[model samples]
Target: MNFETVAPNAVPEGAPLIDVREQNEWDAGHAATAQHLPASTLMENLDQLPETDDPLYIVCRSGGRSFQVAQWLNGNGFEAINVAGGMDMWFESGLPIVSDGEGEAYVL
Candidate 1:
């Protein structure tokens, strides 16, 4: 179960970043380029994932949930990496964030 992990700042621009937080959290704020894929319903929405051999970067509010999802994805034959420290660290690292609305994007 040795899944890979990367810091938020290390995630390259345009990489497929999947946010595994819930609807509320996603609506609050998230990485500007991240895709919404709540961990609760991820399995049912596998079709939404990018169809590429490249690594899929997963994130949550913190790192816990995304870590679990990354492990599951790897076991299921996908190259997924857990974003260490998640959105909180992403925000702390001064990365760009966007909300569902026009307001300021803060980590939820």
Candidate 2:
């Protein structure tokens, strides 16, 4: 099945953004409004995904993982869009990022 992709800056504001990075990476930093859903356990956490017809934007450190996740999700009947360049581009684009820790947000 075909999958969609969008650049970090192209992701719509308030859209459902899912970060598929690992726990340590997520803890380091992530998009302020993104939901954490590590790719490793994505299958087990299917129920945690947002329930909506709207497109789900998937992101990771550099887009590879997110692309894979997006493909799987799309094949499984989800409207998943991979975030091209992922969090790295998001950080470089000056998008808002927050850390689960107390330190300033910086992509891991």
Candidate 3:
């Protein structure tokens, strides 16, 4: 099934960018505005997401997992967009990213 997609740099400001990577990946680095929501726990934490009329963006180390999450969200009646190319692209695009430490981390 095809879900919506948005380029990493095209994600709108203030949109809920749910990072579906594991906690370690999240701790390493993530979009400055992204929310930590590992795909493993997404279904269980659905209620914790922000209420938005616009499509929510899903991101992972690469595009694969987030694409799956986007498909699941769409099937569940939630508008979701997979961030094509994911965090790697986000970092390549020079977007602001936050990390627990000062050093850079791998995206995938």
lDDT value, residue 50 of candidate 1: 93
Q: For residues 5-98, what per-residue lDDT tens digits would candidate 2 score against the true structure?
A: 9999999989999999999899999998999999999999999999988999999999999999999999998999999999999999999899
TM-score, one value per model: 0.95, 0.97, 0.91
Alpha carbon deviation, residue 94, candidate 3 (Å): 1.1
* lDDT values, one for every candidate: 0.93, 0.94, 0.87
Model 3 spans > 4 angstroms off: 105-108
User: What are the per-model numbers of colliding residue pairs?
Assistant: 0, 0, 0
| Model 3 quality (TM-score) | 0.91
lDDT tens readout by residue for model 1, 64-84: 999999999999989999999
Candidate 1: RMSD to truth: 1.0
RMSD of 2: 0.8
Give the top-scoring candidate (lDDT).
2
Give the per-residue lDDT of model 3 (tens digit) for 1-108: 557888888898888899999988998888888888899998899998889898889999879999999999999989899999989999898887888665875564
